[model samples]
Target: MTAQSAHLDDELNLKALSFHAQPRPGKIGTLVTKPAATQQDLALAYTPGVAEPVRRIHTDPDLAYAYTNKGNLVAVITDGTAVLGLGNVGPLAGKPVMEGKAVLFKRFADIDCFDIEVQAETPEAFIETVVRIAPTFGGINLEDIAAPHCFEIEQALIDELDIPVFHDDQHGTAIILAAGLLNALELQGKTLEEAQIVILGAGAAGIASARLLLALGAHRDHLLCVDRQGVIHLGRPDLNPYKFGVAVETNKRTLTEAMQGADVFIGLSGPDLVTPEMIASMAPRPIVFALSNPVPEIRPAAALAVRSDLVMATGRSDYPNQVNNVLGFPFIFRGALDVRASRINQAMRIAAVEALRDLAREPVPQAVLDAYGLNALSFGPDYIIPKPFDPRLRERVAGAVAQTAIASGVARLPLSD
Candidate 1:
C-alpha cells in the first residue's frame, strides 16, 4: 500500500483500539448547586426546606422549574444499535458516544446531561423504559439508534412525554444539512424548487433530511431517493414503510430517469459509492453532500477533479463543508431545555438552521479563533461552520432556538433575562 493509505489504516486502527478499551464505560458526576456549611444549612437543603418546595411544586407543578434542576437537565438516551460510524456495536460499546454527547451539552449549552444506555432487547421495550424515566429530565436526546425503529421510537416518546424528544442522528443531521444546502444554494444563485436533488441513502438521516428539505420548499417532484438495491421508484416490490413513503414523495419522474439531469447529489450511504463518472454525469455546478461517516460516499478529490464547479460536503471533521450534526444538536437541545420547551416543533428546527446559516455568513468570532489558537477566522466556501469550541454557539444558536420556540408556541416556560 501507498504511504497515504498506510496512514489512513493506522488512524482507523488507533480509533478502533481506543474504542475497544473497556476501562471507562460511562461518565456521570455531581455538581453542587447549594452550599452545605453548617447543620442548619443541611436541614434546609435536604429535609425541611426541600420538602416545602416539593409541597409547593405538588400544588403548582410549574414551580418545579424554579425549585429543581429539572429545568436544565437533558436525558441523552440510547439503545446502542447505531453508534456513529461504528454501527451496532451493542449497548455497552455505545455508552462512550452518549457520554461524549453529554459533555458537549455542558460545554456548548450550559445544560446538565445524563447519558443512559438501555440494554433492552426490543424497540418497544426500550421506548417504554425511557418513558418511565422521562419525568426526571427537561428534554430527551435519542442518539445513534437505527432507522425505522428510531422513527417509531421518537414518535412514541414525543406523544407520551411532555418534554422535547430529539433523535440526533435523524433530525440533527437533517437540520445542519438543510442549513448548509440553503447557504450553498445561495452561493450558487439557485432556489430549492428549481433544483433536482438526488439522495443516495434511505436510512434515518436520509429520510429526515429529505423531509426537511421538502418542507423548505424543495420540489418533492424533483427529488429522487436511492438505496442499496438501486433507486427507490414507486411501486418497488420490496421496500419498508419509511422507504416507501420516501419513494412516493420523491422520484416523481422515477429514480432512474431523474438522475439524468440532477442538480444535486446527496449521499448518506456507505463509503466510496459515487464514482467520478457519476459526478461527471451531473448538471454543471452540481452541489453534492457525500455525508457518510469517517469516509464519504464519494472522495473529495475525485468529485472535485471530475466537476471543478461542484460544491461538496461530508460528515468527517477534517474536510471542508462538513455536514456534521454537532453544529445543531448541542445548542438546539440547549435552547429547548433553557426555555422549558414542551416539544421540538418544526418551527424550532427551522429556526436552528437559520441561526446556523446566519452564523456561517458572519465573520467567525475572534474569541473562537483564539480558542482554536489562530489569529483570525474568516467565512468562505471552505469554512461554513464554527468549530466545536466556538463560545458564541450557546448565545447565538441556542438563544435563537429559544426565541423561535416561544414565538411558535411550544415553550412551556420562558427564560429570565
Candidate 2:
C-alpha cells in the first residue's frame, strides 16, 4: 500500500482505540505565563504585589476582571442526563460533548471555559452542586440536562446565581431556530402570528422553542404541541404536567385533529415521524424544521418532493438551513460575560435571532463560502443562514447579545465597543 494509505489506516486505528479508552480523559490543566526571573520579581509577582491588587479588589469588586481571568472564564456545567441526540448517557460519557462545547466557547467567542461533569443524582442536588461552584466562574453554561427537570434547574440557577446562567440545549436551539424561521417565513410571504405551527417533541429544545415562538408574536391558537400521544390539546388526560401546561396556553382552535394544513412543522422528535404525505398536506409554501440530530423527522428530499414551495431546515450540517445550537450559544454567553450580565433575558435571545436573520440577508462572504468549500452561496429560498465556520459570528452575534443585555437592564457592565 502507499504511504498515504498507511497513514489513513493508523488514523482509523487511533479512533478505534479512543472508543474503548476514555472519550476525553483529562481534567483541567493550567499553564504559567510570566516566569519568575529573580527573587525581586518572584516576590512582587507571587506575594507582595499580588496582595496590593487583591486589596484593591476587596474595596471594589469589579476590579476582579482586571486582576484575574474572571472576565474571560466561563463554566460549562452539565448533569449529563441528556447528551446531545444520545439520551441519558451518564456524566462520564457526556464529558466529550461538554469539552466540545468548551472548545467552541474558546474558538468562536475568544472565551476561556472548563467543562464540569457533575454526577448529581437528583435535580435539586444538581442545582446545589452548580451553585457551590458558581463563584469560580464568571458565567455558567448549563448543557445536556434532560427536560422538565432542565426547565426547573435553569430557572433555579438564574434565580440563585448573580452571574449569567444559560442552558444551551434550551435557549441556544430556540434562538437559532427562531432566526431561521424568521427568514423562512419572510421568504414565503407569511407572518408569524398568522401561521399554524406544529412541534413534534416537548423536550428541552422543543419546550423552549414553543415558548420563544409565542414571545415572538405567534398566536397561541396557531401553535400545536404533539408528543407520543397525538396532539396536546386541552382536556387530554394523557399529557404530562409539563405538556399539559403548554396545552392550556396554546392550540385554542380545538385543532388537535391532525398535522394537515399546518403552516409550519417543527420536529424536535426522532427520525421519520413526518411523511411526504404530511408535508403535502401543509398549507401552501409551508416552512418545516425537522431538527432531529443524526436523522431528521422528514428527510429534505422527501419534504421537497411533496412541496416544491417549502423551506426546510435540519440540525445536520450537510443540508441547507442547518439549525444547530452552536450558532447561538457561544456567542450569546460571550456577549453576556463581556458585560458581566446578571441573566440572559428574552430580549438578549431575540436580539441574537434578529442578528442571525440579518446575516442571511447580506451577501454571503467569500470567507464563509471558502470555509464551507462551496463555489457560491446566495440569499434566496434555499440559502437562509451562514454555516457555523463563518468568522463574523464573534462580533455580530456577541455584539447584539451584549447590547440587548444592557438595554434590558440585566447587564452589570455595558459593552464598551
Positional deviation of 75 in candidate 2, in angstroms? Answer: 0.8
For candidate 2, write residues 327-389 as lDDT tens digits: 898899889988889888999999999999888888888988888888988877777876788
Give the clash total for candidate 2: 0
Tens digit of per-residue lDDT, candidate 1, span 350-402: 98888888888887777777766777666655666556666777788889989
lDDT of each: 0.83, 0.85
RMSD, every candidate, angstroms? 2.8, 4.4
Give the clash total for candidate 1. 0
lDDT at position 248, candidate 2: 51
Compared with the true structure, model 1 gives a TM-score of 0.91
Which residue pairs show collisions in model 1? none
TM-score, model 2 to reference:
0.90
Error of 1 at 166 (Å): 0.7
